[model samples]
Target: MEALDSPKLDEHSQALVAMNEVFQRQRKDYLANPYPDYTSRIRDLRKLAQLVQDHKDALARAISEDYGNRSVDETLFAEILPVLEGIQETIKHLRKWMRPERRRVRQLVYPLASNRLIAQPLGVVGVIVPWNFPINLAFSPLTSIFAAGNRALVKMSDRSPRLAAFLKRVVTDYFPREKLAFIDDGHQLGPEFSALPFDHLLFTGSTQTGKAVMASAATNLTPVTLELGGKSPAVVAPDFPLEVAAERILFWKLMNAGQICTNIDYLFLPESKVREFVELTQKIAHQRYPDLQAPDYTSIIDDRSYQRLWDTVADAQQKGTQVVNVFPGNEGDGALRKFPLHLLIEPNDDSLVMQREIFGPLLPIKTYRDPQEVIEYINSRERPLAFYPFTRNKSLRDLYLQRVMSGGACVNNCLLHVAQHDLPFGGVGHSGIGHYHGKEGFINFSKLRPVHYQGFIDGLKPLMPPYGEKSRKILEFMIRRARS
Candidate 1:
């Protein structure tokens, strides 16, 4: 097979010109076939699934190369599996989701009238995928976009160069430019990409970048779904065992080296159990990753990220925050870029680690005297992408579920909620906007157009513009009935 040419980054204007050409082609194709049949949609989804399956090993290797040493298991589990599962789920329910929903007609328009909602496909969707979990972030949303029977144009993050290049080549080989295309521009073309007049735009990245995408999208008044990340918190109820909390939290935190958007950014532990929780987390870390330099433990994505994590920890320590390296002895060689998990205990509010989303193996543990304090503390900050509460107590779990506002929540678990094909995954407030998973995802890329059918007999003739005494009498009767 001939190698696909990578996008040139000589000039931003030239890149935009190329990007717009692709977008227009997709738009034209969409116009040709606005609503695809169930069979056609299923074919598209299945083709995508098979493409992923065929390239699974290659994609994993490219991702690992991009991250220096990302574990194959992590890529398979966090990125590949979710996408494959999501594709199957979409295939299973596409027919039902495509069915028009019957709605009730008002009494006034009752005679030979009916209402229904048609899930019409938006013309074209633009998806901006982030670096971390690149495959899942790109393909997961693409599954929904395809399920909704729309064309798509994806922009991969420049940070994951190898994966981006690999996907650009593979996607082109598998899909037509008008049906599905990938843009792997290693330049400052983000502004231009987001500025396109797409039917719908979905972006997954930092809160600051999300804001810029939203701003650019405003020019076209394009509807957007911003999956932004923030300081997602995990609260360990006193009733829950420290061991369980530590184990579950470490699983997510250590995954992708804690680069996940939904990973617990900080922990709210019961004040008395703080020390014990730390020890338990350390023990769990040791058991899971006995050697820090092992391939199972993912390395930091790049030099910039490695330095950022180090700077965060150093700043916290300087501000009188207690720093505990979970694996103290085995500081992997600098070449490997594998940094052990660092626990920041009670980092000051002004500390960098506490203020920013530490997208690394640095975990900040905050203590709360009362569960209510935990609630108040979490609420005081911006709502996060996810909230995890490890509690077996029904009342406490319900309390957290009701009180704490997050994009999504998991009870007694971490990060599994996003994997559920039936549930919608999205963030709230600063975390994200809109949802995309299962039926909700299908709806996200579709315009739920309400259609009404009426018989030849005009039911509203009595209430026409040229109202008379008869119309007044009918209005009076309706008012009396409403009042009664």
Candidate 2:
């Protein structure tokens, strides 16, 4: 026979091959152990929490390295602490969540049958994590997945290579490759990763990318939970205190340099309060970040995002909007990607900053004379991931709450609802499609299988006969019983 050479596989092809192999291994493992016991699931969760505890500093450092300068406190407060707390909450509830519920038997079955609602594992789940809040986004869902007695394969963002690599290396110590694996984006394998036939998939990122992920997962008939971003709005009612609202909003708006998905994208200030809000924000911004170069302030994720923010400000200013730089004359260090916060006072609706989601430290203010205007304007667009109505007035608060629809909301505040482990965290409409956190998280990742057990009595015996008068009479009685 003549010697023949094998065809060479490109990088993506090889990555796909490796991913498929891991997927198959996980699938096979799931088949062997379809439903893990509570003890095993608890052990898995503990390992996850321990992994974070042991590697907290290193993980924070790697995240900081990924961003030119991510705040250490922000990483710990936003990512590390929240994840650990979520895991603890999941552990506390897993036992109750695992128990099957006794459902009432249908009247047709009567006393002859029993019904049960059992939550069973849904095999391996794939988690597509985003660069922002990488740790919490990845492991918070993982907490739910594992608590539901399922394995997972996490794909990390390309932008956070260091954290991805760190996770890939450390996750192995706690879990076998078949149970849990972290795949790096070294080969840009996000599309390939989403196409795998996992039991369920959870993706967290931009709305556009979420659509692509949903389309990819559809091919495999895989269910997905999308945590997408939109221009989440905050309205400061006239009844509310402007300075208090200013302090709270500014804290979250600048927490991750306004890179948060649920961060207030635009603010609706009462027409009379615009200038005071601007002045308060300027004072707060300067006080909080006196020197933009200090480590207390985080840099923009990359140069492209940094440039995009600056472009947005320029476009707004060119359109005659009043742009107030919180730190005047100190036009941030471009080398460090530290772009100072700019308050675009009443930017035009056509302006770039207002038209799109500003995922940076730029806030656009919109003046509103009536709450109805705020309601009408927001309802006209895609539903947001979050809505912030900062007012203590019960009627006004209830008015906004009843009218607006969003993935979630934080009254009198912003961005704190996501940190609550008890509440399910996901998006709505363009914002996202399903939820995952606490009990809801467990249910999202599991299949709620219904089980029926037949008893000694056979309720249908009298009805299952030849078509005759007796059968008709029994059916009539049954119908009357149903009506009753």
Candidate 3:
């Protein structure tokens, strides 16, 4: 009789198997040396810094190519610089973060016991990065993972194939597979990657995909830190200068063509200032981006995204909303996928532009009567990732800050809080789950195990459950003292 043949695996299944093999190897290596010392972690971080610095130009070019016309300055400032700063901050504070924290023992066990929290390394971490700011999202979390002394496996977005390939090559050159690995097969293996049993997982993407990733991670009981996106709003006070607010909001709106997760999705303008705000925004936009065809202006990521923006604008226009293109005559170089900015005035509540997170150069302006109305309007919807209030009044600032609920906030600026190395950046509700940046990032990837050390003396020996006469008398005395 002929021998039976084994079942053949498909390409995705084979990829899954290969990924699991790498995970198993990393797990084994982590078990062998569970905790890396401070010096070793610093060395690893320095190497990563060098890796980014040495290839900054190449990485920028690759990212620009992926987006067709991404601004090189934007990539350098928003992506590479933040990652380098995060690495340096991690190295600077790793020694302190790794030291065991001394905690106070309970009064009941105070005599012969002491308590402390040991920041132990979680064995393996999995990171799923998005196409926007791919390098920053990938390496910023990697800095924390390494600082926490854990191994990591990263899955890059399929939309950013060039950057993904470049990262894979550079990362492989710098570190071993057991230490750090990048999965650049695009989305073909994303489900398998999320299903792997990792000690911790961090995903940065849209809320819908974040939910799916969370569900996949649930099977393994793995903890997750999701950096998802939502409709973040910018509230401009009636008292503040219209030009300043418009310039600030417009600056962020056009950054990377408004692909950032925390970009101002809409504006809350006092009813009177709406017209002036629009005029100021148009002038600022024209002066800043004189020619939409210029390289300084970023293009939409792809045809699908480009068409989405156009459709959103059209839907708003059809719904009786006034659509204003900041650069009217300059439609941008269509061949390069660059599109001009569109500002929507009072779009219908049910319009696509108003309902969804417009991750593009489309801005919606909603008028408000009072601050309380603005607060209620924001609270009625799902919580956003960021809330920007531009006001000079201290009371108004405090009122908005206190009333509005979001993952993070900016007093008078936009998109600057996420860049702070000391801040914990994450979302709440529909926005995101947990945080990962600076010290919070370190703690997020670590297991804070509480340890109790006992001395030779046993203070509770007399209170043992023997139902003896001495035990009863002691318990009665303690109860009386507690009551008194």
Q: How well is each residue in 1-484 modelled by candidate 3, as lDDT tens digits?
A: 0111214765566667778888998999999999999888898899889999999999999999999988999999998999999998888888899999999865563476888899999999999999989989999999999999999999988888998888888887889999998887654888889999999999999999999999999999999999988999999897888888888899999999999999999999989998898789889998998878788999889989888888888899989999888888766566888888888989899999878889889899999989999999899999999999999999999999999999999989998999999999999999999898999999999999999888667778887777799988877887888899
In the range 68-92, model 1's lDDT, one tens digit per residue, is: 8999999999888999999998999
Which ranking of candidates, highest TM-score first? 2, 1, 3
List, in order, the clash count of every candidate structure.
0, 1, 0
Expressed as tens digits, the lDDT of each residue in 1-484 for candidate 2 is: 0111224766677767778888999999999999999999999999999999999999999999999999999999999999999999999888999999999987565677789999999999999999989999999999999999999999999999999989989988999999999988989999989998889999999999999999999999999999999999999999899999999999999998889999999999999999898889989988998888999899999999999998899999899999988888978778899989889888888999978788999988899999999999999989999999999999999999999999999999999999989999988899999999899999999999999898888887777857789889888987899899
Per-candidate TM-scores read 0.96, 0.97, 0.96
Q: Candidate 3: TM-score?
A: 0.96
- Give the C-alpha miss distance for residue 16 in model 2, angstroms: 1.8
How many pairs in model 3 have backbone atoms within 3 A of each other, for residues 3 or more apart or on separate chains, i.e. clashes?
Answer: 0
Q: Rank the candidates by lDDT, best first.
A: 2, 1, 3
Winner by lDDT between candidate 3 and candidate 2: 2
Error of 2 at 63 (Å): 0.4
Q: In model 1, which regions exceed 4 Å deviation?
A: 1-11
User: Would you list the clashing residue pairs of candidate 3?
Assistant: none
